[model samples]
Target: MHPMLNIAVRAARAAGNLIARNIGQQDTFEVATKNKDDLVTSIDKQCEKVIVDTLLKSFRDHGIIAEEGGVQGNPDSEYQWIIDPIDGTTNFVQGIPHCAVSIALRHNGKTEIGVVFDPMANEMFTAARGSGAFLNGRRIRVGSRDSLDGAIIGTAFPTRYRDRMHAYLELFSRLISNCADVRRMGAASLDLCYVACGRFDGYLEQGLKAWDFSAGDLILREAGGIVTDFMGEPNYVKSGNVVSGNPKVLRALLQVCDVQNLPAILK
Candidate 1:
């Protein structure tokens, strides 16, 4: 593993452990509403602190962008860590056991290290640039399903952005008709990891922040999958719109989703 990636794994595991210990203790923590359907808890803040602290111990000058805490450290640094301390805060609060701690390191503006740790399952999904993706230290890859007929597709609700609901529904309706089935697991990072591990052939969602998908996106790509914006461009990180899967499935999904014309509606 790359040195930075190793540190990322360590930080993610530490944060995940903190979250795991706090699961089912929602009543003990203060929950803040980010929006109508978005939430944050004390656990999220604490976990982010744990991750940021762990990384700074190894590289004090590196930048940090966390979901709960926002930006910290040297923003102008060539290295930046993007973190989602608890990727599925709502799920964690509801005792769903499907949340995860996601951490990614970008060097010179490109993601080079990715780690997503699911504490409940003790599954660590990781990938370093040029290194293949892994699940629990075992190499993993995208599913071989060439089409959507029998493929399981993963997605999440665009609850935070109701204005995009119409566009999402149009895409969802199309997917429901073409794919074998669809799942909304409430965790974008885990959904992307699932696609990497062959549990789901493809995944898509909108209204996500960089932290929500940065780590998982790299893992999926390293697992032999393609990730792109709705227009099949490498702008998902900035656009917050993602469509990812194996080559064939991704192409088919793009066609069905009609993502080429999504920018207008999405905006």
Candidate 2:
């Protein structure tokens, strides 16, 4: 393992444990609404602080872009650490056990290290650029399912776009008719990691932040999954619109949902 990735794995695992220990008990800690659909607990803030503090102490010069703490560390540096202490806040608050703590380190604009740890399942998915992906020290890969008809797909709800919900519903309807099944897992990072491990064959979403998918997408790609914008363009890294699965299934998805001006999940 690369030295930095080892550090990220440890940091993410530590944060995951911190979050897991405080799950259902969070209702009494304190809750804040980032929006109607988005919720954050006092634990979330604490977890981010722990994650950021640990990383900065080790690599004090690397920049950090996080969900709760915003940006911290040296912004002028070439390296960046992206952190999402709790990816599925609602799930965690409701004791659903589907959220995760994700961390990604970018070097010169390319994500070089990624970690997504689900303490509930003890599944730690890690990846390094060009090195491939792993879960619990074992290699993992995207599903080889050739077509959407046999694919188990996943999606997420828009956080603040009720008016766009109908568009989301229509897309879900189309995918449901052709795919073997559709799941809305609430945690985008976990959903993408599941796709990498073949738990789900593919995943799409509408409206996501950089911290939400940056690490997960790189992990998926390193796991041999293909990632792209819904329109079939290679726009995922910056646009935030991401479609991921095996190459065959990804291209097939592009043919189906690659509509012009369609609402992109990551955008």
Candidate 3:
């Protein structure tokens, strides 16, 4: 593993341990609302601090873009660590074990290392730019299912982007009718990891922050999956809209979503 990737794995594990220690204490922790439905808890802040501090200790000059702490370190540096201390805060607060700690190191605008750790399951998914994706040290790959009718898809609720709900529902309805089934696991980072490991044939979502998908994006790509914006372009990280899966499933999803004709509200 690259030294930077090893650092990221260490940081992710540290933060995940912190989160696991706080499980079932949601009521004791002070919760703050970032928006109508979005939330942040003391655990989120503490985990972010742990992750950021851990990374800085090894690479003091690298920049950081974290969920709770925001940006820090040298802004002009070629390397940036993108982190989401708790990818599924709602799930965590609700006593669900679907959340994860996500960390990614981007060099010169491209992700070089990605790590997502789920403490509850003790599963660690990781990848480097050219290295293959892995789960618990075993190499993994996207699912072989190619047809939508046989594919199980993953997606998120448009809770944070109510304005685009109508467009999302339209796509959701079509997917339900066409695919074998659909799932909403509530964590974008884990959703992407699931795709990388073949847990879900394909996944899509919009209105995500950079930290939400940066780590998982690189993992999926290295696992032999395709990731792109709804327009089938490679700008999902910037557009905050992502669709990913094995090559054939991704192509099928883009055609069914008809992203090019999506409503203005979604765009």
Candidate that would win on TM-score = 3
**Candidates' TM-scores?**
0.97, 0.95, 0.97
- Give me the overall lDDT of model 1: 0.90
lDDT for model 3, on a 0 to 1 scale?
0.90
Ten contiguous residues minimizing lDDT sum, candidate 3: 258-267
lDDT of 2 by residue, 1-267 (tens): 899999998899889988789877764679889778789889889889889988998999999999988889999899999999999888888889888999999998999999999988888999999999999989999888999987888887665777777766777777888888889888889999999999999998756788899889888999999888877777766667678889888887776674664553333
| lDDT, residue 134, candidate 3 | 96
- How much does each candidate deviate from the true structure in C-alpha RMSD? 1.3, 1.6, 1.1
Question: Which lDDT tens digits does candidate 3 get at residues 1-267?
Answer: 788889888888899998898876866797889998888999999899989889999889989998888789988899999999999998888889889999998899988999999999999999999989999999999999978987889998788778888888888888898899999998998999999999999999988899999999999999999998888898777888899999999999998898666764256
Q: Is 1 or 2 the stronger prediction by TM-score?
A: 1
Candidate 1 positional error at 108, Å = 0.7
**Given candidate 1, what's the lDDT at residue 148?**
92
Candidate models: Cα lDDT each: 0.90, 0.86, 0.90
Candidate 1 per-residue lDDT, tens place, 47-122, comes to: 9998999999999999999988889999999999999999989899999989999999999989999999999999
By summed lDDT, the worst window of 10 consecutive residues in model 1 runs over 258-267
Runs of candidate 2 exceeding 4 Å displacement: 261-267
Sorted on TM-score, best first, the list reads 3, 1, 2
